[model samples]
Target: MTYTTRADFMSGLREALGRNNIPDARDILIDFDQHFDGGAAAGESEADVCAKLGDVDEIVKQYISETDGRFTEAQKETPVQETVITDNEPEKNMNTGDFAQTAKEASAPEIKNERSGPSAGGIVGVIFMDIFLFSWTLITLLSLIISLYAVTIAFAASGIAIFVGAIMIAAVGAAGFISTGFAPISLIFCGIMMCAFGGMLVIASIAATRGFINLIIAVINLNARRFTGHNVCRKIGRKYREERD
Candidate 1:
């Protein structure tokens, strides 16, 4: 495998393993690097190497299973360490526990005040920054929506205009044929070609309009889902791509 391709595959596998909370992910990634290196040494293409390894999800599942097996084995093989306390050490253990509790309490106030000393100006600055970011995002989103609507409207209007123009051309062809006693075949042919071209333009525009409409609908649905605190767009996109593929 080429360096770039190997890196990409390893990166994806690492992310998949991390998302699944697999243990020793770095070690697994190191193992994968060695595998890729071996494959490259054998002069195999990246695709062929990856095919032998299987899909990222499948690899992550296998890793998870292996990790669980190792954990179980370790648990079974390891001896549990129990604190063997004699009767005389009870007071010592109690004193140690009390000392630890007191130390923890003493540190609590310092931790709490660590970030609680922000000045009034700092608080106001943070508030201003948050408001600025919110306004900027809102403006950007609104501009995008307006731009989409404008483009859709323009496309739909062009479609209607082209349809009307086709009708006019057909009308002129009929009138010319009647006035010329149907004598000029070229005129009739030219008119028919013009009408066809116009019809095609109208059809193309309609298709474009429909595409824009679908895009708008998708955008609206995405925004609605976001507003409702549902992050289903990613899932929907994945499903769509799966079906398309």
Candidate 2:
């Protein structure tokens, strides 16, 4: 069945795995949990993440095939009956050899899926990405973030200055040192308003900074995957989300 939410997807997967007697179900669940978390941190919706993950039934079937085959092989290697123990030691050795061979065969596909050498076109793309696209994009994002922070600081400084100046004016007016044009009470109110506005700006700037950082990291990961065939984006996303949380 279609699952739009992480909770539904995970629950369905867990149930399916249990029905199929899949081993290491906990590990499987944890992996999917991280996958959802990573997608969330990358500004993807739960539905989008689930769509990328594909069907729950298919995932369960995959786990069952991989895990159940190993379990069956393990059972076959074990001497369940007394008569089986009477077999020659060489037969036992052969059974162990067969199990090892089966394991190697099972893992072969995973080895093939790892990043391989890039082709000529891939090499050219990587060079272009590194030299122009990536460099300029990173610089622009950093500049934006820095500018936002500078504005935030400027607001905070302005607010503090106004607050302090208002206090000084009130003290001076009470002492009758000089005839200030504006009312001391009005100046104090304006100062408080500036400080409040600055505080709000500080919050907005922090959120903008985080968003820009996430965008920069996403762009880098996209290029890395496109050129190098290294799928580390999800891992980085998970790490970023974890740190933020």
Candidate 3:
């Protein structure tokens, strides 16, 4: 359901029309556009559409052959003039150069070959995601989630250990105070600080856990929306192009 090759094919067709001096080039292009759109709506990929259209060079030759008579007649009626080529027309020259560059970039195969991950095969990364191979975005987010969970577990364990230690210290202090009718200020202070530190650790653990959970939920929702939006747009664009063509 991808239309990666459509624009390249259209560009090549346009150039072919120009080379042949076709008078109704725009109309012909529109028809081709419609044909591609119709094919796409029928669940064909851009590569399939292009294959159906056949070779670009062959199509160009066919157009030139079909309109040879009209081209010859037009050339006879058009006046021949001596055009002076000069370096003074830098702006026009620059415009022509820019147009050529733009066309070259647009028709480059890399346009269709770009992947969603570090390696080639964007669609493969999505459909065949594995532990070793997947989208970079997914890998990075998953790593972050794993690290966050690891931190959360460590914090929770530390908090529980500290809390237990604090309870033991407080119980000792209470027992000594009851047995001897006196408790050392240092022991009481130490117990209170340990309990406070343990409580803070527990709170930090909870916060980290909640944050990691929310992040995972957000990532799932975001990826889902992005995938759905892309598909919807692709469908609408295919239909719109078919209608316009």
Candidate 4:
């Protein structure tokens, strides 16, 4: 192609490269413009030059399409944009490439909890979860043992209270007017205390069950071939060799 035709083609090629920048375009341009003065030396007419070079768009496409199994930087780095629609609102949107770069960035999460979603039952739930997760097994194992000792003492004391209260009720005929009926009130209060203690006991039992289950699961994972990337053959051989030694 003539100098003018080659110049026009190269200008467009440069713009396309800026956006899609495939190496194939660079290679094609290299082969197509083998002239010493960069395709100008050919001195062919503009129309004839373009005709020989063929369709510029089709040539660019063909170059990009010749990818072998091996991946270049551009090919390997091409963004795979995936769309995710959660129940939460979409606060930000960008190309997949840019989003991934931001994810790997060494910074704290920009979205704060308050802005992310609605709050829970706040302090009440927090207290219950703390009781369920952190107490008994984690923070108060010894306290729980002490509480067991206290349970034995309380049971013996309450049984005596029950027997004495019954006898008093029969003798004094004053079950209805014992300390202006505060005896029943106090007993009701004791019942509530016992219920709270029972709830705590239940939580402790659940936490212990979960902890032992987790331990079992950990042991199972260690023995499994997939978790440690050891095959059954390797395990059998190791056992056999251990027995021999």
Best by lDDT: 2
Candidate 1 lDDT over 1-245, as tens digits, reads 22235545765775675566565454455567667778989999877888788778878777767666564543433221112122112222232232222222222223223324545554454446437653464456557656655655565555555556555556766876435344345444555555565566556555544444443343333333333422222212222232111
- Candidate 3 vs candidate 4: which has greater lDDT? 3
Q: Write the residue-wise lDDT of candidate 3 on 44-160 in tens digits.
A: 988998987888778767776777665666553431111111212212222222222233233332332331123334333334433343246445755765676566566556555
Rank the models by lDDT, top first. Answer: 2, 3, 1, 4
Cα deviation of 197 in candidate 2 (Å)? 2.6
Model 1 TM-score relative to the real fold: 0.28
**Candidate 4 residue-wise lDDT, 58-159, digit = tens:** 665665566533447865354221112111211121112222222211111222222233234433443453466434443465455557656655654665
Winner on lDDT (1 vs 3): 3
Checking candidate 1 for backbone clashes, the offending pairs are: none
Best candidate, TM-score: 2
Candidate 2: TM-score? 0.45
For model 2, residues 158-209, the per-residue Cα lDDT tens digits are 7778778888987897788987767766767777777787788888877766
lDDT of each: 0.48, 0.59, 0.49, 0.41
Candidate 2 — what's its lDDT? 0.59
* Collision count of model 3: 0
Query: Which pairs of residues collide in model 2?
Result: none
| RMSD to true structure for each model, in Å | 23.4, 20.0, 20.5, 24.6
User: Worst lDDT window (10 residues) for model 2?
Assistant: 82-91
> C-alpha displacement of 78 in model 3, angstroms?
11
Ranking by TM-score: 2, 3, 1, 4
Residue 138 in candidate 1, Cα distance off native in Å: 1.4
TM-score of each: 0.28, 0.45, 0.30, 0.25
